[model samples]
Target chain A: MKMAWKEIKKSKAKFIILGSIVFLVSLLTFIISGLANGLSMDNAALIKDMPAGQFYMDENAKETYNLSKIDEDTEKHVHKEYPDAAAFSIQMGFVVDGNDDQHSVSFVTSTESDLFENVNDGEIILDRSMQEDGIQVGDKLTNNQYSGEFTVKGFVDQKKYSHTPVAFISMDNYKEMYRTNHMQLLFIPGQDKAETINGLEAFSNTAFLDTIPSYSAEQMSLNMIIWFLVIISGMLFAIFFYMMNVQKIGLYGILKAIGVKTRTLFGMMWSQMLLITAIALVLSVSFSHLFNRVAPDGMPFDLGLETTLQLSGLFIVIGFIGATLSGIQIKRVEPLQAIQQGEM
Target chain B: MTAFTVENVKKTFTNGEIEEQVLNGVNLALKEGEITALVGASGSGKSTLLTIAAGLQHASAGQVMFQGKNLTNMKQEEIRKVRAQDFGFVFQASHLVPFLTVEEQLLLMLDVSEKRMHKQEKKKRITSMLQLVEMEHRKDAYPSSLSGGEKQRVAIARAIIHEPKLLFADEPTASLDSKRSQDVMELIRELTKTLHITTLMVTHDEEMLPYADRIITMKDGLIV
Candidate 1:
């Protein structure tokens, strides 16, 4: 083990090059993984934390509950029976501030109930991302399409859907502006026995969330990008390691001629790869955090410990497989060739 | 008794349809504690014979016995073990690993040999081996920093570090100047006598012949 380390240390330049490539690949992997997780969070943050065990939506609503409608009378009937039921209307659209600056937003209107408790009156709650658009408290933002003027009240941490920031408002105000007689959805908390009330379709919260248009599409798109990046990075790592092993063919021959077992040579090569990959992963993760700090607002990225661990495990496994595949070439080396070639 | 015996050794090479016989029915015996020189012209099958004896190559039709065990009947791994523990070789070119210092090179041989030694004991053996070659002071220098003659000396120290009974030297002094060549041959002879090692050296340098206990001259793959 000591001698193997010495040999690797002597070839520091080659190892550095290999390490750099692996680091770059690992960095890309980390970023892509973060993006995938961020996209999922951004799309579901509003509903993920909602205090509802199940939501009711029309079965024929196609992809989104926003387009689905249930009557006020039916909502009231379900509330009377379940006692914890709540009804809400959701609208996703764009709004222009007084300065004519257009910003994407998700508008939610909830009845005064625990399930709809996140909603506040004429004051609109904006996501922190809206700060970049120069909107602040006391500033008026309007959506002429919805026929209302909204006051920027305060900011929420990360409430968003489909890349748009979300805002909460009262149900009456929502009804006056959007001019709809029916509520788009209903929420029921811990009332699995609630009978099907008139003029409303019943669903579990998980099912209703999936019915949001662009939720699956958005997730699929981000996941595809993440998958592509992982495959590309893995292949690039394999190729770089393979080339380095090929370059050391002569050294392998010499070691073999000196009666070093093939298994020992394999152990050295694997250790070298693992050492390089571990160092590269650390560097790449550090660089990723540094970049995240300097990035401008709305650049979606979310790197959690879970994601980091997953990517690290992936790199180690891929690196080991790559090193093993490259090591197959060692068996082809003839010890006699080293004797003929003059050892350096 | 002979340390190694070769009987009717023959090696033939075929390129496409043409066949070339490099060695034809060559018989030889290498006795213990004697420095035997094999002198031959190029293409006289001398290197091939050495390779066969070292178990680095297989003979077309012959038997090579090292300590009365037929090398031809041994498995590949078994042959490697024999080479590792019982045989030592010095090539025409000094084949020191570039990454290892002179002392480390010698220790590497001891590490591979089946014989187990403690770390301190291994270090002491390496130190004494280097001292034998008068390279004790240069033990820490990598092969790249060494002069040609010094590299050859390190190579010799590495070869004999495991104290193998049989040593094969194929043109060991081929790359050195005349003075260095004579010094290397004398060192080889002295080490063989001091360690009671049987040595077979293949050389074309007539000037170094005086150091050999016996000489076999060859031409056209036949002993002259």
Candidate 2:
């Protein structure tokens, strides 16, 4: 360990270059991960925030939220069985504020329940994001399909769907706008096993999120980019260490001749790997979180602590594997060959 | 006293369909506090015999006895332990770790040998070793900054820092000019007598042979 540290101290430029690459790669990974997570929330915060449970829709709709429609009797039957169940409907539509400007929103309505916002007739509750666009409480809004103007009741935090701010309307208003007397889905929170209701298909919370339009595809592409960055960084890390080891082959052999155990040499490399990786991770994590803080509020970038920890753990494991792979050359080195190589 | 002996050591290298015998039944012994030089032509297997005796490589059929233990019968780990604790080596080209300072090189040698010295004693010993090698002034300098002779001096200092029982010098002066060669040879001879460490050296410089206590010449892997 002391030998490894001495090498690094004596050769700072090489190690700094390595550390910078790790920092850049890890920083990019964290940023991309944050964007993926933030976009996921932006696409379906309304559903993601809900407790774990099952969602039921029409079995014939074939795993689509918009096409799925639960009949009134089905909703009644589900509510009868689980009094805490919430029946909800969602449709993407536009609302005109007092300024006469049109804004797209995921119009939502739900039965009386604590899980969602329920407004009185002719009143609307919107995601707080809409408040930034000049919509305010008591402002009257209009939808082209509805006959009455909606008085904006209030706003809730992080209520979004399909990358649009959610606008919660009354069941009567939803019925009048979409001409739907029955809710589109039935949600029963906190149930480990979904009840077998006839004509209804059950979906876990995660499976239901996939049914959201463009949710899985968008997340899949972004997640693919994140994984690619991780893999590329791991390979780059291994190549860098491999190059370093190649240059030190003679030194390693001479050390072996002098009775330095191969394991000690490996420990040296590992300590260097750990020290460099640890320093880079700390900086990148700090910078990524700092970027989160200073970024524009409208930007979809949410780097959660849990996600950061998981990715950090992955980087360490990959770094270990990479460095160990390169250290194999050290074990194969022959001291006699090094002596013949002349001048380390 | 015969501190180490090699009996009928033979080594062969095999190609796809050919085998070349390098050391053919070589017999040798190194006396305590004596410097034995092996002089030979190129490909004469002097270095091979030296490496075999040093336990840096294995002989296909032979016994290498060191202090009552047969190195040929020992496992690699056991041989490594013996090398670390009882043997020191100086190669042809100094072979100092490029990134370590002269002082750090010696300290690392002590660490590798697992010497049980207090921190203060280790430091004092390093200081004295540097003085003995005439490298006290360059103790903080890295190998890159040192001249060829200075680097060899530091290498010698590192090899003896742990005070091993035997020292192997394979062309220790091969990279130096005549002046530096004589100076290094003189230092090795003086230290061998002072420390009472057995020495095994391989060289081709006839002018440098006078420093050895005894010289054995080899023509075809057999000493005459």
Candidate 3:
């Protein structure tokens, strides 16, 4: 350990370059991961905030939830079989507020269940974010598809879909607007395994989220970028360590010649790798968390502690594996080589 | 008394399908506390024999006996223990660790040799070794800052810090000029006598041969 540290102290510039590269790569991965997670939430907060469960949609809908139409009779049968199950429908529509400005919202209506907000006919409950846009309780709002104006009942928190705030309306209003009495999906909460339903396909909560149009593609692309960055970081670390090892092959030979145990030589390499990686992780974690907190509200960026720790752990593993793999140099060195080389 | 022996050691190197016998069945012994220098021309296998006897490399055939144990039959780890605890080396190049100070270089030697002494005692040993090499004034100097002569002095200090039973010097003065070479050779001779160490040295310089008690000349892989 002491020898390793002394080497680093003597060769500060080489180690500093490697450490800086690690820091930049990790920080970039962290930030992109944060954005991917945040965007996922933005795109599907309503379903994500729900308890773990199974969702059922029409089997012929071809895995597209919006195209799914669960027959009213089948919905009734599911509710009967799973007493706590709820039937719900979602559609994109615009509501005109008192200012006569149109705002897009995911219109939702659900059968009577504790999972959804309840409303009498002609009354509407909206996501609380609508309040920022000047919509208030008892305020009248209109939709071109519905003949009657809705009186805003209240607002719910974090109810969203398709990157838009959700507006909960009566079943009658949803039926009138979409011109369909058939609900799109049936939800049964707290199910470990989804049970098969007649004429419908079963999906877990996460699988159902993927069925949302553009949700999987957007998240998949962003997640791919994050992984690529991680892989590049690992490769970068390995190449740097290999280069450093090649440069020190002669030094290793000399150390071995002086009766240093091969194990001690390995210990020296490990300690150096650990020290460099630790410093880089500390810097990147601090900066990533700092950015997480100060990011503008308009930007969808959320870096949770769990994700940060996962990535940090991954980085350490890769760095360790890389350095250890590069230790072939130490093992391959011949003490006679020390007699060959005149200097370090 | 024979402290170390080399019996009919033959080493063959194969490059592609062509085989070259570097050392061909040669035998010799070194008396305890005596300096035996092997002087030969280039590629005469003097250095090869020295390295084989020091346990730095293995001979393809025959035995290297040190203290009644055949090094050729020992496991790698076992040979390593012998090298660490009983053998020391001074190469043509100083081979001082570039990152370490002169003092630390000696300390590392003590550590590798597994010397069981208190920290203060080890420090004292390092100080004494440095003083013997006339490098005590530059204990804190790095290898890079030292001149060719100074680095060789530090290297000599590191070699004997562990008080090994045998010392192997492979052209230890080759890197220095005439004056520095004489000084370094004098230091090696004096230290081996004081420590009662059996020494095997390989050198091309005829001038340094007089310092050894037994000067064996080699040609074509055999002592002539």
Candidate 4:
């Protein structure tokens, strides 16, 4: 281990170059992963904000939340059985401001419960993002479907569905606008396992999120990019270490001839690898967290501490595997052959 | 006393379908505290025999007896332990670790030999070894900063720092000038006598023969 540290100290330029490349790759990975996570949040913060629970939808809807409508009787039965249960509906529609400018919103309504923002009739609590568009409290917003006006009650943070801001309206307003008395989904919070209802199918939170039309496809592509970056960084370690070991074969051979244990050689290589990776990860994690704070308002980027730690752990493991794979050459080195090859 | 003995040692190399026999039924014994030199042409298998005797490679069909133990019968780990604790080697090139300073090279050797001396004692030994090699002035110098002869001097110091029972020198002076080569040979002779260390060395230079107590000339893998 002392020899390893001495080598790195002696060859500062070489190791620094390796460290810089690792830093760049890992930083890029962190940034892209943050963007993917942020986009995911933007796409489904409405459902994601809910606690872990079971959602029951009509069996005839066939895994499509939009097409599902829980019968009135089943909704009542679930509420009676699970007193904390709530029935909610989401419909994508447009609201025209006083200037007749149309803004797309997911109109959401729920039965009386603490899980949702229960608004008064003809009043709407919109996502705070609508405030940036000049829609203010006490302003009258109109919907063409019901020939009625909605007064803005207040603004809530981070409530979105299908990439659109949410407008929480009363159940009477939702029923009047859509001409429907039945809610689309019945949610029972904090259930370990979803109890089977006769006419309804049960979905866990994750399953219900996947039922959103574009959620999986959108996340799959971003996740692919993030993993590809991670794997590329791993291969980079393998290639870099392979090259370094190849150059030092003669030195390794000479060391072995002098009775240095092969395990000591491996320990040297591993210490160097861990040191380089740890430095790189530290820099990348710091920069990515800083980016999370300073990114443009329009950029969807959300890097958190937990995700950063998980990714850094993966980097260390992958770097170890890569470096160890390259170190197989060290095990194969013969002292006689190195001697025959001349000075290192 | 015979400190080390090799009996009918052989080594063969296989290149594709062709086999080349390098050493054929060679035998030798090294006396304690004496330098025995093996002189031969490039293809005479002297280097192969030296490597085999040093436990750098295995003998195909022979026994290498050191302190009454047959090295050829030992496992790889057992052989490595013997090589670490009982043997020292100096090659044609200096072969000092480039990253290590002169004093550090000797310290590394002590570590490899697993010398469980106190830190102060180890440092004292390293300092004394540096003075013996006349490298104390450049104890902090890396290999890149040292001249060829100086590097070989440090390499020699590294070899003998652990005070092994046997020393193997494979063309240890081949990389030095005439003056430096004589200096290195003198160092080897002085160390072997003062430490009572047995030495087996391979050389092609007839000028260097006088430093050895006995000379074995090989023509075709057989000592004459």
For each candidate, what is chain B's TM-score? Answer: 0.98, 0.98, 0.98, 0.98
lDDT of 1 at B95: 78
Better of 1 and 4 by lDDT: 4
Query: What residue pairs are clashing in model 1?
Result: none
lDDT string for model 4 (A1-344, tens) is 29999999999998999899989999999999999888888889899999999999989999887788888888888889999999999999989999999999999999998889999998999999899999999999999986679999999998988888999999999999999888999999999799989888999999999999899999999899889988988898889899999999999998888888899999999999999999999999999989988998778788878899999999999899989999999999998888888877
- Name the lDDT value of residue B198 in candidate 3: 88
Please say which candidate is ahead in TM-score: 3 or 4.
4
Better of 2 and 3 by DockQ: 2
> Against the true two-chain complex, what DockQ does each candidate achieve?
0.50, 0.81, 0.71, 0.75
Query: Which consecutive 10 residues in model 2 chain A have the weakest lDDT in total?
Result: A1-10
Error of 4 at A6 (Å): 1.4
Candidate 2 off by > 4 Å: none
Model 2, span A153-183: residue lDDT tens: 9999999899999999889989999987888
Candidate 2, residue A23: CA error in Å? 1.5
TM-score of each: 0.83, 0.98, 0.95, 0.97
Tens-digit lDDT track of model 3 for B41-89: 8999999999899888889999999888999999888888898889988
Task: Please provide, for model 1 over B112-160, each residue's C-alpha lDDT reduced to its tens digit, 9 standing for 90 to 100.
Answer: 8867888899988888888899999999899889999999888888788
Candidate topping DockQ: 2
**Can you tell me the CAPRI class of model 4?**
medium
TM-score, cand. 1 vs. native: 0.83
Q: Among these predicted structures, which one has the highest TM-score? A: 2
Candidate 4 Cα deviation (angstroms), residue A197: 1.8
